[model samples]
Target: MKRSNAKIISTTFIILLSIFCFFKSTPVKADSLTAKYSMDIELNGAKKTLAGKENVSVHNSSGADLKELVFHLYPDLYNKRETMPFSYTNTKNVPLTEEEKGDISIEKVLINGEDTKFTEDNEILKINLEKNLKKNDNVNVSIQFSLKIPKGTSRLSYFNDVYSLADWYPVLSIYDLKENRWDETKFYPIGESNYSDVSEYDINIKVPKDFVVVSTGKEKEISSTDNKKVINLTAKNARDFIIMISPYFKCISKEIDGIKVNSYYLSTDDKSLVDIAQSVLDASVNAMKFFSQQFGKYPYDEFDIVESYYEGGAMEYPELIQMPKYVTSIEIQTPSTKRYIDAKPSIIQGAIHELCHQWWYVTVGNNEYKEPFLDESFATFFTAYYFEKCEGQYSPNAVLRSLRYSFSKLAEINPKILNLPCAGSSVDKFGNDKTSYVQAIYVRAPLILEDLRKMVGQDSFLKIMQTYFKEYKFKNSSIEGFLNIIEKQAGSKIRDYIGDEIYSGEYKAENLKPTDEEINQIKHETLKEKIKASEQANGSVLGSLLLRVENGEKAIIVKPSSLTKEEEAFVNSKLKSYFGNSYNKLSIQSDNSVTENELKNSNIVLIGNPWNNKIFSLMANNIPLSINKTRVFAQSFSENSDSVSGIFSAKNPKNDQNIMLAIFWTKDVSTDFYFDTYANPESIMIESQFILSIDNKRIETGKF
Candidate 1:
């Protein structure tokens, strides 16, 4: 019964979230009209601890009667004396706020230095204003607080030998204009998009001369007076800010496009650490050019790559990113003892991914908490695109990371349930990090874009992306808004596809139309060979795909041309059984341009686009990917090698909940890599010509 209820909730989130993105309209400038924020933080640091206070400036862009100003008290979530709250990303300090001895709360509400209306819900504290000011009226809110770090969670600021303090203080919540959905649930340990009114932050920190700090804003001034270092920082209009302080840290710097690039790491990091940081920056700056030229000029002074203790490989903040320096820490026991040692996945990939977030989340902000895919997918696709651009390679072996992940997740979850907002998904699922971050953010997203690229030319496609970024640069967006952009640029079919498949999890997955080169290759190799091999054969393979209305019973899934009439009849009969209703109704184009619905009728769809003579115009340099493979890759109707996907029936169908897909392929040698997820590779694999299936009862496998 609980399982049934869980399914219902998951579907709700998926549907609502999809409804927001699938059918987007024109972009909006949410930040331009709503508000802007800036900050100045002053810190006092020592050996085992550090403390600071911030002053914020805000402009109320909303016309509504404004009363409560919400401050996202992030660190307070960890102070629970019971189960300690923590994530691999941002910091959450325990005992973060000093409880006021006399009155209501630790925070002294000061609007223009006077008390105002304020309230606290869970950990988020909302401040009230004295006057209901009209739109565009500005105000200042100053917060003075001291924070103490728990030894386990301290990676940002530390006191004695090596105390690092991360996620230490209060930052502002990102407000959504389409709807101000204050997703104050909890910080996703992975990372998330944030909002705060734009302001100027002037911070003065007094730390020991031995300590060094890396932060979000520009370093205004640094001076030492009486053995105490005063480091002042001032940040412009950014969503949020973060600071990292440590005594045992070291720095290596480089310049990209004239912007100062700083890399921070522990002294223990190898010498190559500097080069790796530069590579990440070079790749990032190159990626920035791709986006800036396509989207808009990057809206900041500098971007940072700092070595942090954040779990996973890396995490992106507004202007700064925390990167994992070592693949195997001393804790891994022995590296040589282990045969492969996982090749020690470095911080390089992690840095590239996080820096890419600058465009998707930091600069052109989205509601990441609700629809993580908006950022994750954009970045995932960006990751692939950047790899090809910088490394001068194909979309690397990493594309399968998304393929397997989406496929497995699709089976375990119904798209209906998977679409739920991350906040709601947590209750529907277990933890927020469990499904939403993996599925909605990483898995399903890249495929949507990959499919988009396949449908349209890369030149036309990249133009649409640039327009989307330019339009939605500072505003919160709706699904309708996104649909409008695609509709105006791409054809209406694309808009509908986004609405139905990408948005509703009802994607066709029908093989995309191959280029003329690919179609001719099939014609020359298969049909032409058969014609030469047998004098009696008069028809062309094009005729088979363009098989007239008369031949349509359901679909014509022709395999190796050698077949008996009995086998042909058997295949036709099975195809009709699967697509009986559409069999007789379908027809092909005179030019043999197969439509989506026609392909949908087949038991297996083959969308083989040859890389020959085609140019991918993603980068300024005409980099090419030679994707020439001579093999028949086959999988069941639902069994695709690309992604493990699940189609959840919003309303449980009375029919049997059985879905077993068998993909048959004919190739000389199958590549041995990983599957079962977009990232994790321990699920299951059926070797060349082998079978793979998924159902609630059992996973059946057999070769045809």
Candidate 2:
């Protein structure tokens, strides 16, 4: 009995020692665990076809015991024709999952040392573990799978110049925060994580020989035999992986800070085809050179560019960037029939943007699934920045001009931040809504960062940014964390903006519209009030403000002789509109002409004018008072008038940029024009300033 007790105590001590060791070695993470991975992908001819296998290693960093493993098979699994009764329910952008994900049968699933039941639920394939893993314990799930790339997915990938398939298969899902703990209640809406994702990914692929493959990670090694050649790769702690294979590839290599650029293109019919690569090479070199000078250095070797067919666009892999055929060829026989000659900027732009991903998306990783704006915005900003710095001052403007095609789309919508699922989990809900992931991210994040730059000035802003890059260089962090560092560096300016993010809540507002009722009310109110308040004794101040007409305003009488040539011409030219097609009348009422002395007797108020807000007292001798939350009107006016001031409290005034305001004025007998003055900020506030220059045609605004 004593011996048995001794053995038990010894075993318990050993287990406790192991536990202590683990706790000491684990890195600290918040609300979730940090998982590290090493994946090996190689093309093998053993199956006489391309085969893929994954040896995923995971660590349970949190308090919860992970029970199951879920894999996201994002490929266009099972496509069905548009059917009658179109229920149209696709949760993760995958509507036909059961039928599509049904084909691949998991041949084996082993947890610890035993077999388990791994099932498929639409695009989600999972293994329900036989036993729950304890805290700090690790698990490895080995999966061997083969895919028959489906037809017509808009999905594409290149296989040794012969097969270019995209969206062909369901790659493994990424568990960024919590491992497989997601709510299917809503598809990923947009921005930030609702829960957490935790899982390690290690993929192994085997393709045929005579192919140069561009993929998601740096090349580890190449092992070859007479029958086939294989390349082994290991991408650790990354969100997704892509491998492009082509046999028609011509390899051209260059070195930037020892970071290798392996550009792939088709060996063209002409000998000058060489420059295609040389151009791409130059772009790669110049982009890296410019970016490193501006931001930091490139961290990886073995970047690749290969021939593409789908829209001739480029998708960047970690070490390799893929190129389309025409994108690289130097042949430019015609305007329409062009190659690298026409695609120089895109070739460069795509290369620069993708390469920037090394820092933005890949290095300073954020919740891309949550706030993709965090990623794409930086890319967009940098894309323009690179163009301007590399080419010329105005070059990026042209590049940015193309992006502005969507500005009206942006202006029409309010930014919506919906809690989304883990990356790769919610494939359905993600799309380019005018404020979609890419656009919203591309627009707002940079806007905010640019605002930041303006706020702290360039030098301090760059200092803060440099610190950000150095701190979060290769780790995953939250956007809040970024804001925290900025707040620490720039102080309360950024803090208030960030604190207001959730405080503002989420409002999905449609574009502004001026209703008939609203417009009619403005017209009725203006006529009634002005006819009563005219200090000219001609009935009201607006009476003198008006050009001249009868009580009913059937006609407008203008004193062209009493006005200056500029004023008469302005009045005459502006009068045609109201009298041209409408029932308004004009008369030559010499007394109705506005005079400096008459202004002292009446109160003239122009709706929707900041200048009106500025000199309200000067407006026919009215007391000037300013306050917020006041309702105002905008007017359409005629030409050639002296001036007046407006009275209203602006939220944030532009101190540096001139505060310009526009208003439209229309009189009972005729429409007229006037000018006014508004306050310019004296520089000290960091907020949005609205001049409220009501675009007289269709103006509708409200209090924020």
TM-score of 2: 0.55
The residue-by-residue lDDT of candidate 1 on 1-704, one tens digit each, is 00000011134643443333223212223344333332223333321333333455555666554656776765554454322333443333433333211011234445655556667656577776777644666666655444555444333333233433444556666544456544465544444524444444455665565567677777644787554566776676555667776665676666555566677666664655555555666656666666666667777777776765544446777678877544432232333321122222334556667777777777666555555666667777777666656554322324433343334346456745345333212222335344444654465546667677667778868877888878976555545666688888997998777656555543323353334664444333333222222211221111122222223334323232333465445434533532334455643221134433433444222211222111111110311111123321223333323322111101001111211111122221112211221121111111111223232222332222
Residue 164's C-alpha lDDT in candidate 2?
45
Consecutive 10-residue window with the lowest summed lDDT within model 1: 645-654
Candidate 2 lDDT at 7 equals 13
Count the clashes in each prediction.
68, 76
Judged by whole-model lDDT over C-alpha atoms, candidate 2 comes out at 0.44
User: What TM-score against the true fold does each predicted structure earn?
Assistant: 0.59, 0.55
Report, for every candidate in turn, its global Cα lDDT versus the true structure: 0.47, 0.44
TM-score of 1: 0.59
Model 2 lDDT per residue over 134-235, tens place: 667777555544444322212232222334433233343434335546332211323322222322333344455555555666554357655445566556
The CA lDDT at 611 in model 1 is 21
Best by lDDT: 1
